[model samples]
Target chain A: MSIIIDQLNYTYSPGTAYEKQALKDISLVIEDGEFIGLIGHTGSGKSTLIQHLNGLVKATGGSVYYNGADIYDADYNLKELRTKVGLVFQYPEHQLFETTVLKDVQFGPKNLSLTPLEVDLRAYGALKQVGIPDDLIDASPFELSGGQKRRVAIAGVLAMEPEVLILDEPTAGLDPKGRDEILDQIAKIHDERHITVILVSHSMEDVAKYVGRIIVMDHGRAVFDGAPKKVFSHYKELEGIGLAAPQVTYAVNALRERGILVKTDATTVQEAKAAVLAVWKG
Target chain B: MIRDITIGQYYPADSVLHRLDPRVKLTGTLVYIVSLFLVKNLWGYLIAALALAAVIRASKVPFGYIVKGLKAVVILLLFTVCFNLFLTSGTPVFEWKFIRITKEGLYLAFSMAVRLTLLILGSSLMTFTTTPNELTDGMESLLSPLKKLHVPVHEVAMMMSIALRFIPILLEETDKIMKAQQARGADFESGGIIKRAKAMIPILIPLFISAFRRAGDLAMAMEARCYRGGAGRTKMKPLHYHGRDAGAWITMAMFVAVIVVSRRF
Candidate 1:
């Protein structure tokens, strides 16, 4: 399902001295089956904006529409909306409370009032989708390593069979290998299931590698929203907003500035290498 | 969903109450509470109420915030008023079966409610004006004399300060944990009392584990900082009672005397 946020505004602790405007008139359209990366500094309202997609936070002004239906309409079921747009919060593994990985993964499907057999089937399918071993499903989630626990938590959301999955800093705190493994798993899931994926991250490298579209948020506003390559090309603006383009993009831009004519749009290391080689051959 | 709880919330202000020595404020609260109970008649209660209102206004804390603070003790206030109204034997003004509503009982209930309300407002005023660190510092200084009697005054104050400091951090952690669990379909909102409590297991387990982890990290951090308890520790900001603090105390004493004299009549 496509998501559209129309002139949304959010203020925290309203009518109090601590009142803060977390999101300011943000409007954006997220297409179906697209991999979108949301990048922002701390307290820039990226989290607040995404939370609005699943109805976790009601917009103080304006509305969110899921395929032309108002998400905040009285007839709309928030719980069902959440199931449709699964949100894997930052450091999601800290939420693991079930006895076994299987039970934890089954929790989401069970909430939908699915039959016991269907719950089991979906839980097993989700575990497989996330590449978790069948044998490990019976093991306690708390006993698993940090990466394993993170996978289990993601699997728990996947079991609900959400059409659009929103992950906030999924690769955070993971080692390089673990991060790559998780990102690859996410990419595979997106391709296989044709699900819309919203990845919120601070790492430009991760977004450059995986996301098709990049949305840069600064101070509760969407400063940039376009194709990843196009967004990275605005290097000066990105840097001005306390964000960096991928390292390879920065390197390619530097090379071009130094009279070495190369494609400065290359965001990945391999792409940068190829562009530099092409420049040398010319 | 649990983030909206605003009990004991500190409002950052630069009012006189906020800048006063914490020890002085703490002692002043104690003395003011004692004086509230010493008042008997309607006029005495009115004087005490006016004194409390003056203090609250001088503190520059919003009146709405004081009302919010009173919300937590609404049931207690009601109980006290009801008990004083019904249980205190006096000349009856109205009778209904065994229940007697007396003129004296009505007056007693009104005075009791005012006293309790003022007492709560006075204490809450202290918390609203003082940050947790300042309160703990004042508490340590106030309790310092008990150290000679072998009481672990510093240790207790240290514990209190740490607890207060961690309260907000823990609350934020709990909120994140709850949301994470909710994302995992741990239904915290629905179900009967037993079922809801059962649902909290997932939240509580992680929260407890994380709490223990934080405690371990804190201990290690303290050790790394060469923390050796309060044996030879000196505060960067020592407490000193000024002439203005003395003047304030004297004014409070005079206010208490006026209430005492008025009540005796």
Candidate 2:
């Protein structure tokens, strides 16, 4: 279940007045069940990279292999590739169309050509996985709150039972509570299902909190790919490319500057606090 | 799929036609189209072609670019040609079963094909040179007299401009929604007519919702800024006629007169 990207390059509106190379030569291998964060500034090619993983957008050059199968092969089934690698776009709430949340969530499973009973079961299981309440299952998705509608939209993709789930800026525009709730639910789901989850976000903190591995994209190139601490260490370079490290990274650094000697690589506030406490006890 | 829609697309360039008053371009296009229909004989058509050639030369838009617009209208041209070739009854040039081609029918078909090609070429030139804002401003100014007859000319112009502006946004929305659905295993390409159309519902719904939401937001934003229609509105860049605009009107009149005289004499 590994995805191997080989020297991918993509140009938008190629050869036209508006031609732009959105993704440059980049290669990486993502192992199965790895929780990865794909973060970058807006228009940094993070979204484009994620889209290529599922074959939504074909790269202008290079190839993508999922589970030892070349996706760009002549006979490769792109439709089936999409099922195994589901992508939830930004502002997923706008994708909610069915009258009821249940029906909307079932849309993906139905498209998979599952039996009605199996579709309903998958939909229910997905909604449950997302922590959507039972009372809201039959409710009109449009009538729900913004956060609830977004959850239903996410559930739509989750019902497809994709081995790899990719979400693009899923917490964008949500309140902090809503953002944390969604991210917590995602982390819990990833823990339970062990599906490869790639969360694309602009916020470093959000990625730092959950993902074990973080890939930082700069102008269509993956400039850094490693554990959160390793990526966060190059905060200054990331800021040069229009991305700031999480606030906790700065605090940890500030403490070490003040001679407190806490670990500077603490990615989250809790990690920073624990590091500070450890230094104090010593 | 969205890229196929090339209508009303403006090609920006600095040229005599691009600088001309949009009102002049609009009226000239109308008069030019009228002249195409007014042409009755081969001589009239020759003069018509000459006038179009002159206009196109002055427009500074590339010849190949103008002809490219015909790609979308060729079907209509062929349809007109086919009907005229086989339907008009006259002295038969050739006959085979129910298929017939007559002397007059052949002439009519050829003439119609020329007229339509010229028509598309002429209007496309106008759109290519004039921006949508200028088009609406010209439309509103030209139709201002209708306000006395209870026509909401300003409102109509505003609506047209808004619709034009929303087209690109809606198209982008459609593309995004289509991709989102496709990622969920929605099959849009490999289906029959009905199945394909049914697949479109997922995309169409979100697009319409987003459109309505945008419209609502725009209306609210407009109202917040005290936009109450054209009751007492004044233009930030009010249009004025230059010496060249009058010159263009006279030139257009002369062109049409030539076509009319050729047809009459």
Candidate 3:
């Protein structure tokens, strides 16, 4: 039900002159039904870490446990593990290959050896979860708007009925409205399904708003792991690693500098608004 | 699992072979391959092998890395050896129904195997030491005479370099697409040949779309950069021949001389 990564290390092209160590001794526990944000700058091993979770990339050292069972052990079924822990990669829309959106969404469940009826059912349910209109479901995914195409792609993973859903930069390359919609839909899925959700992103604001806990990775190590408020309070140290809290947190800190009483840890627009209102009323 | 492809891949290093003029390396490879074929006896082959070993040592590229390039042509080498073993006419050492192993056949097979290995290794050496840009520059320079015959030599060289550059990029894209499909419970393994081929459709379609999209983007970029046809082009850093290049030519001349003398004897 939970994933425990112990001392994971990965090096690409080991022993070659082009060898590069991508991940270094990264150990963490993702408890059941937890909404976690894994944030890091580019080349910070974020993609490599998520790939390890689903067994896409094997760890050179250490082990990953799913529900207290070592996933890398000889007996574990890798396909079953991949289904249980779904990964929606960055620019996931490019993965869509079926002619129609519904067919593309059904690809996952179909591959699970489900009955055709069951596969379609799961696909329909996933499409509904992602809120794709029925008419658009019959249209070619390539012909849809960029945002719609992305939703279908997400639905493709959602149809797998994974217990632990990991999204790597799910809101990347989306317009502001599209980004908000995706974030809200992801939050809705987490709440309704009660599944463990790990969002990998570099946009500090997006993760700050939704994820209860944030794990900040820098140079292949999780440097900070705590609640969003507690982590954002260390904004100075976060910025040292090329990361920042949400703009509102900076704004709140600016207001505090003028001797106004406000919580400097506010990350979302609503939290900043409420904090400002509270100070004004006081 | 598909990352083992090393064809046309360059290994950057600071060594005499790596720093040699691309034209010299290219011409040297050609001469070396021709000389490898000219070897008539064991002594000639030994000389050629020594020359190859010297080049490998001077390049500072790992001996194992250069040897690994031989893996790509293993099947071809085996086929040539097999063909030479059973087909060449000579005094028979072992004879069976429709199968004859002769002394000359054995010698021919051995020599052909060695020649093929050297051929692949020699070409791989040139590519491993030379960057794609330099290779294209050398190729365009070598083919510059073809321009007199109305051939678009520059464009042809550009195409070759672009194709060479995109090999790794396309492989990376294929890897990503395969992983994406696998995440969705697609099993690429554990299938019969036909079933496995069917499974590849999901990967192929997306890869092709992305590749075409990339091609379009690259075309646009080239056009935006005002990349006209190679007519009236001026080089940014024109090819220069140093004293080492002269030494390289002398060495090539000596290699050819040895092969000529071996053939004469």
Question: How much is the TM-score of the A chain of model 3?
Answer: 0.97
Rank candidates, TM-score, best first.
3, 1, 2
**Candidate topping TM-score:** 3
In model 3, the clashing pairs are A1-A67
Q: Given candidate 1, what's the lDDT at residue B193?
A: 100
Which of candidates 1 and 2 is the stronger one according to lDDT?
Answer: 2
> TM-scores across all candidates?
0.92, 0.90, 0.95
Segments in model 2 whose C-alpha atoms lie over 4 Å from true places: B12-17, B41-82, B94-96, B101-103, B242-254, B261-265
Q: What tens digits encode model 3's per-residue C-alpha lDDT throughout A1-282? A: 689999999998777778888899999999999999999999899899999999999999989998999989888899999999999999999999999999999999999999999999999999999989899989999999989989899999999999999999999999999999999999999999999999999989888889989999998888999999999999999999999889888999999999999977788889899999999999
Ranked by DockQ from best down, the candidates are 3, 2, 1
lDDT of 3: 0.91
* Local accuracy of candidate 2 as per-residue lDDT tens digits, B116-145: 888888888898888888988999999999
The number of the candidate with the highest DockQ is: 3
How accurate locally is residue A30 in candidate 2, as Cα lDDT from 0 to 100?
95
